[model samples]
Target chain A: MLYTVLPLEEVLEGIEQEPGPTVQLTLGGITVEAEPLGNFQARVVRVLSTDPRHFLEPHCQPGFLIHGQIV
Target chain B: MFEQPEAEQLPEREAPGLQTIKELGQTVTPGGPLAEEMPFHCLTIIGQIEGHLVLPPRNKTTKYEHVIPQLVAIEQNPKIKGLLVVLNTVGGDIEAGLAIAEMLKTMTTPVVSLVLGGGHSIGAPIAVAADHSLISETATMTIHPIRLSGLVIGVPQTYEYLDKMQERVIRFIVQHSRIPEETLREMMFRTGELVRDVGTVLVGSEAVRAGLIDEVGGVGTALNRLSQLVAQREGGMH
Candidate 1:
């Protein structure tokens, strides 16, 4: 159970908001799982790799836009 | 010439350094990697403390595993004179929050917690576990009873652990801070204070008045108090 000061409404806000169309692609050698913004641009969901350094990459930070081919 | 070709061939290797220069206009590099380190290990517990379960990708969560080890490292590290826990959280799993609060209370290292925005629910216990607790002028805290989530199938015995869970939170907070059990309980059951829930929301100085937080101040006040504790401990050792 969430023991927070925030209202229940705020806590559960985006739970059902959107069923995001997510995709996995490689960008800058890191396996990035992202949601496509357009043909070549996508917003990063997460950097799916074992390398901790890859996760620390600013470009791979969640919500960061990535530009690359859909592979 | 070989090094130049390698760097040119691999653009990904240069991204971090190139972006650092673009933003901060400097590079610490390998020679000064520890230059960015500070005497005080500032640990922030923000967002929702989601415990073991990984929340959605968009959810900003402070997971249990993410912080518990840091507390251990801070205790072992000689260079870290004190710990500054900056909290702006909408509390999460009771087990996770209490584990953190218990560790904070037991650690030999001096701790000062600063509450900004809000340190509600389980955050309350963690805040008070510190040597000194400070709250930002506009920050808030919520005092509410712990209730079980999900289904309760058959017997009345289902609530047995729930009662114990709540007791842990209350026992920890009261032991760590000056807030009396009666006062905390009254606040928890104050139905009129909250529109829908049975609870009270303490804003800044109200928390101090309730004896849950030590002072109505922010980052500067917390740091000053922490340094004083560190100095006092060092002097005692000497």
Candidate 2:
């Protein structure tokens, strides 16, 4: 699975209205749930996997989500 | 009955000369006027300078953590009339040394640097960082290229990255000191100076001749120059 990282502000600007509990991000087909996580800030953080079409065999370890916030 | 105890009984060892072990300790105390008043406002010395966090064993270099706060403190304190920078460093981390040099370049207070034992590598920038620089007639300075320590990728991208970093150092040194970029580059890449290294080793008078240092003098000359600069600045203010 491929992932995309983007700044929170950029993601918000692209979305028309307040996203729901699970908002589908535009870059690198990523669907993140706002309910499960907290609000995004000005920095870039890894959200979820990118587009489903390109999603290959899951090479990542199970039971853990790769998420990173900019320092 | 004892046939005069053999001479072996005359003490096997000569009196051990007064073995004196001197342990010099540095004490930390709260700031006070007594601490603030001194002949020289502040003395900044770069003992050993290697341009990285983890230094070589037996390597002597200045630690940025130790020098940074001192520079900031000296700048903010109005009581500090002069700063004396003593350089006896071999120059380690370029960024760290340059950070220190940049701070010294911008300091409002007068600064004088005296290169003692040896000021080489990034020490070149530090030696010239002050308003007036001095060196002992026997001291030496080495002008060398940027060196990498740990594992480094050898791809084109890696080379590009290193080139950019080197450029940053060169730009900073040129901006702060009188040495021109071309001359510095020539010195940095000069071959056969060090047995296995590609740099130029300049002795005392040579360093001054190369425009890397101001004059050939020791502590007294350095302090005198700093005092003069301080007096001039203060006089202008009054």
Candidate 3:
């Protein structure tokens, strides 16, 4: 898979309007929909693709929540 | 050659000739003093990588202007069997490092990288650019989102530019190394790893487990692997 680093703010701005593409991400069976948040520094990796039960797994929990502001 | 005058009466003008003779005796061929004894393969070390127009710590980092030529030379040179890169850097100019990494990725010669101390920031992409990668047991690597150091305008265009640059780095890393993009992104934006920041630090074994590095070995292992790769490539050619 191709990976790219993008500013959180740009992603957030995109998310503020409409949910773009379905970002399929998996952390040990916990599939998440990487939706863009209005805030540029944050993106909501909401659990969309997996059942709520998957979240109970130790590795499937919210892996990391990064916080930062657009510069 | 002019004969020297008596020691005490020698003219000062003769000093230059005498000095030239001494220099001639000391000077060796451009190949260097131990060129024959030492191997012809090149192992360039770039210590400092200050950005833009500025030169860094070792007086200079690997500038694309210089590095591109060197890579071409290495490719053409029959003596250079393989390339071993040792990185301990905080990352530098994005374009410069990317250019160097691109060359390394495409080079015919086997390339190996060893992270001696720390390979953080853009250095992450560079460390994985090689054909094979290794890290010392004590070395550390950091995965973080792109950060612009100097004054940055908060305009939409600026944000877009930064995003594009970030994508390039991520794409390169994911393509070259075994690490997955989403996993890397989690690490990049992972909170609590860096106080008041979104990044994670992985030690030697951790880096290996994360798939950022192939093995946890130092220079010796790195060299051995490089040599083996070269031999394999040569055998394949035949």
At residue B4, what lDDT does model 2 achieve? 42
Clashes of 3: 6
Best model per TM-score = 1
Is candidate 1 or 3 superior in DockQ?
1
Count of clashes, each model: 0, 13, 6
Better of 1 and 3 by lDDT: 1
Q: Write the per-residue lDDT of candidate 3 for residues B148-220, one digit (tens) a residue.
A: 6446778899888888998898899999888999999899889987876788999998998998889999888
Grade the docking of candidate 2.
incorrect
CAPRI quality band, candidate 3: incorrect
- Give lDDT tens digits, candidate 2, residues B1-238: 3464454455645222111101101122438555456646544444444333434334333556546656766776676678898877755566787778888888888988888888766677776788998889999887766654346777888777777877877787677666778998998899977787787888898888877788999888888898899889989998
DockQ of 2: 0.01
DockQ of each: 0.23, 0.01, 0.01
DockQ winner: 1
B32-146, model 1: which lDDT tens digit per residue? 6565657897888989987754455466787665467568767877888999999999898888998899889999999999999989899999999999999999999998988
